[model samples]
Target: MMPKITTNRRKWKADLMNRVQTVDDNDRPATDYTFKRVTYFKPLGVTAQEKALSVQEKAEVVKRINIVMDHTINTKDFGIRIGEQLYNIERIWTDDEKREMELSLSYVD
Candidate 1:
């Protein structure tokens, strides 16, 4: 039998963000609640893109990242934050061994 991989290859730090609703001081609805970290992020890196989008003669940076993390993480319920930039989970794929998950993340704004 092949030896199982035990150590996780992670270098970048990431935070998981969940949406929360709160009332403002004026009794109005507010959505600026602080994000709570669910778990420590695993190995992550920005993937190279084949094409860039040009909006109105202006170039837009398309940031796509690949994240390898624990299999128990539920990315659908929250977003990811890395280096002051927020990213949305575009896709999730599990490895062949089912020990880790690959998260395809896209930068927000």
Candidate 2:
């Protein structure tokens, strides 16, 4: 059985509609983007009445978290930004981290 789709797109979105402005091979409207529904969930958390964590247990969790973060982050990285930008100001993060930056971007009216 085909699942029903809940659509909330522009008027020319679906295939079989006669007034749709443009049609593709599959009969759906030609679009620059695809849409999908996303879902979020909350997990059942630890119940307070079940048990109280000891100080040792709390420290263990912090230690495990740092180990995970150390493994996940890439030490060397580069990135790209697209914009009309200006230049020269600075900020600092950790003792070794620096953010030398500036921007006075403008757009054509």
Candidate 3:
């Protein structure tokens, strides 16, 4: 069974975006991303983890958030934006009942 969502917890909002490719004046290829307001849905949960390696001297952080499922969401054509930061969708998990989905997102600063 899915966990219950409360009204007070529904404070977080995110945008669903689609990537578009375009050519610049110099004939160089570029990406033009457009976004649409999905809804004001709260994250069911959040998990943050960090990983580091000495050889590469690089650190990576991945955050997982769950929200109520929207039928329009698809991994192939859409991304998630919270505030001004854009996140890459690494994975998506939808419940059997299709009530909610968990999104694995990663971004580097």
Please tell me which predicted candidate would have the highest lDDT against the true structure: 3
Q: For every candidate structure, what is the RMSD over all alpha carbons to the true structure, in angstroms? A: 5.9, 23.6, 5.6
Tell me the TM-score of model 2.
0.13
Off by over 4 Å in 1: 1-6, 21-34, 38-75, 96-98
- How close is every model to the real structure, measured as TM-score? 0.51, 0.13, 0.66
Query: Sort by TM-score, best first: what order?
Result: 3, 1, 2
Report the lDDT tens digits of candidate 1 across residue range 2-104. Answer: 9999674555667777745679899998654247664444654444442232233243334434455455455456667777877665556676564556666
User: Which run of 10 residues does model 1 get worst, by summed lDDT?
Assistant: 50-59
> Model 2 over residues 25-109: C-alpha lDDT tens digits?
9988752222222212111222243223323233111100001111111211211112222111111112123211211111111
- Rank the candidate models, highest lDDT first: 3, 1, 2
Candidate scoring better on lDDT of 1 and 3: 3
Mind giving the per-residue lDDT tens digits that candidate 3 earns over 1-109? Answer: 9998764455678877886778999999976668876656555434333233211334233566677777777755667788888776666778858477787666623
Clashes of each: 0, 0, 0
Residue 70, candidate 1: alpha-carbon lDDT: 57
For candidate 2, what is the lDDT?
0.21
| Candidate 1: count of backbone clashes, pairs at least 3 residues apart or interchain | 0
* Whole-model Cα lDDT of every candidate shown, in order: 0.56, 0.21, 0.65
